[model samples]
Target: MEVRSAPSLLPILRSRQQGEVLTYLMCDPDRETSMSELAHRVGVPLSSVHREVERAEAAGIITSRRSGNTRFVRADTDSPYYDSLSDLLVKAFGPPHVLAEALEGVEGIEAAYVYGSWAARLHGVAGRRPVNDIDVLVLGEPDRAELYEALGGVEGRLGRPVNVVIRDAGWLRDGSGSFHATVTERPVVAIEIKKQLGRDPVPQSS
Candidate 1:
């Protein structure tokens, strides 16, 4: 089930703006957001966001309400496709979404990060080459088999092999080590798993 790269969500979605809009709203279903907020987060014009919101509402994908001068919108959890769409969005953008979902409920994952070439591009690595595999640096003592089983879904979604390197607090503490030095020196995409707060968060190096 290994893949070479992440799959594009554009084909299934109406446009890039639509995908962004879905990712934002779907990621935080409980939170209600305003048109301006959605526009800002999606990096699209207010008009475009408004149109997309309207379309989504008509399709019963989103629900809207008015609070005086501002209108608030939230995903319709009751929608028939709610779970399905949520899964699709997560798999479509595996870095955080899929990775986060996979790591959920796993035993001992402290903090996880996406490193190497894929992370480099996300960190705006200039002239970065395409990534054929995803390099994940996991911290803590989670079972290796369990971790791989979790990431198996992500491998299919991203169309790339997920090469995971497990490390405990001891390895993370050794700043002198080559692996630690390289990850600390480069861009790393943190996987924010709320339950596994094993230690203080490691700030990504700028």
Candidate 2:
């Protein structure tokens, strides 16, 4: 696929899919993933992801191997571009992924989403001003202190401020406020929080 001419959050990349694919592989170099899982995580179609992975592999940006009938890919750590490119990806396209990782096992959280300008840009909405910070909306009854503490370092990691808004699940379902209305009306990207297994679980009581 040809590079998009439209302005993108990561201006240097060919397409959002390209950025997502590269970020997923490069930012987590130690992990290897199947193409289908890569597609699911990046929210891009399998065909598009396959093409991007093929191009990246051809350029030595990533490497792939066959595991039975499955094709798995990972970042080529030896590539001269690995270090710099991974850093760039982490800064530009790493919010949802990074936030998800950070909030993975935090208790009392039902769902999380990134909304506002960052989401607008991710959803391909052209904007007049550059996105300066991330706005996250959490839906659940998580401990306020714990939630904030969990997200404390996100700003440093992303090199920008992260403003999070907490709302209970009841409010999301029944509230009629303008804030709720606006958020429901706008583009929001869901953060996928995977459960941590085979490790000591976070204590329910401190």
Would you estimate the TM-scores of all the predictions? Answer: 0.62, 0.87
TM-score (C-alpha) between model 2 and the true structure: 0.87
lDDT of 1 by residue, 35-109 (tens): 998888556788888988999899998999999999999989999978778666644444665687788878888
Give the lDDT of residue 104 in candidate 2.
78
- Return the lDDT, model 2, position 137: 83
Predicted model with the maximum TM-score:
2
Instruction: Tell me each candidate's RMSD, in Å, in order.
Output: 7.1, 6.6
lDDT of 2 by residue, 117-156 (tens): 8887876777888889999988777888888887886778
lDDT scores for all predictions?
0.72, 0.80
Error of 1 at 168 (Å): 0.7
Task: Report how far residue 57 has shifted in candidate 2, in Å.
Answer: 1.2
lDDT of 2 at 51: 92
